[model samples]
Every structure is written in C-alpha cells, then in structure tokens.
Target: MNIKTEFSDKTLTAIIEGDIDHHTAKGIRETIDLAVEEKNPSALTLDFGNVQFMDSSGIGLIMGRYRLMKLLNGNLELVNLPEHINRLISLSGLFSLDIIKNKGCEQIETRE
Candidate 1:
C-alpha cells in the first residue's frame, strides 16, 4: 500500500492507496501518526479512493485514528469510500463514531 499525505491550513489529508491488511496497517498507522504529530492539524481526511481491499485491521486503524483526533479535539473524515468498504465500516459500527463523510462537491474547511 502507498500512503500520501497533504497538509493544508491545519488539515492533514492522507490519501491511501492499495489494500489495507495486517501487513500494511502498521506502516500506514506509523506514517499517519507521524504526520498528525508534525502537522497538528485540527482535522484529518482519509481518502480511500484507491483502496481496493481491507480486513479487520483497517477497522482498527480507523478506530485508532478516530481516538487520536478526538484526543486533540479535532475531527476525522472518511471520503470516497468504495461500496464494499463502506459496508464493512458500517457493519463494524464505525458510523456511530461520528465519522464525517464527504459527499459530492462540498469541500471540507481546513483553515478557516
């Protein structure tokens, strides 16, 4: 899996590509955590547009990040989720965590 991060106006966007399984989750988590610590963004967006597959580890990754953002009084958004992954997230009860969804053209305000 490849993880690319973009920081703008205190918002850190991590565009994740490829499958997220146990093998890749550790590296992905470390990368994202480091970015979050460095940027200290008030919001985070995990763009899963290119993610093809995910296992339970993916859910753990998301949950962990959610906690991290909450601790910093920030927010976490999940965008461009493929239908299968969306179902997995929903089935995992992750929706109750107040994960923001980017639908359509509505942009997420990062700085102001």
Candidate 2:
C-alpha cells in the first residue's frame, strides 16, 4: 500500500492506496505512526478512496490507530470507504468511532 500524508496543525490526513492486508499493513503502520509522531497530530483522518482490498489486518490497523489517538486525547476518522469496506468496518464495529464520505478535500469533524 502507498500512504500519502498531509498535515494541518495538529491534524493529519493519510490517503491510503492499494491493498491493505498482511503484506502491506506493517509498512503502512510504520509510516503512518512516524508521520503522526513527527507532526504531533491531535487528530487523524484516513482516506481509503483508492484502496481495492483489505482483510482482518486492516481492522487491526484501524483499531491500533484508534487506541493511539485516544491516548493522545485526539480522534480518528475515515472517509471514501466503498460499500464493501463500509461493511467490513461496520461489522468490525468501527462506526462508533468515525466514518465520513469523501467530498473533495472537505474538512470532516473529529469524532470521539
């Protein structure tokens, strides 16, 4: 997977592309974590517009980030999720966190 990160003050957005499975989850995790720390972001937004496939590892990644954000007194949000991805996230009960639709770089509200 490829991760493109953008930061605005204490908020960081990560645009993720490609498949998010065991093969790519580690790299994504490391890259995103480093960026979050370097930026000291108080909120994280994940964009999955270009992601084609994901498995349980993707769930793990999201959960891990959620935990990290909570520890920092921040929040996590997701956008551009396709129907299948939305199903997975809902089944995994990630909706209680944050889930938004992509609308041309819109600034989504942070979720607790």
Q: Residue 62 of model 2: what lDDT?
A: 93
Reference-based TM-score, model 2: 0.85
CA RMSD, predictions in order: 7.2, 5.8
Q: Which regions in candidate 2 have their CA more than 4 angstroms from the true location?
A: 99-112
Q: Write the per-residue lDDT of candidate 1 for residues 1-112, one digit (tens) a residue.
A: 4999999988999999999999999999999999999999999999988898998899999999999999999999998887777777877888787784846523332333
Candidate 2, 1-112: lDDT as tens digits: 4989999877899999999999999999998999988888888998888898998899999999989888888888877876677777767877776555445543433336
Q: Per-prediction TM-score, please?
A: 0.89, 0.85
RMSD in angstroms between candidate 1 and the native structure over all alpha carbons: 7.2
What candidate 1 gets wrong by more than 4 Å, as runs, is: 102-112
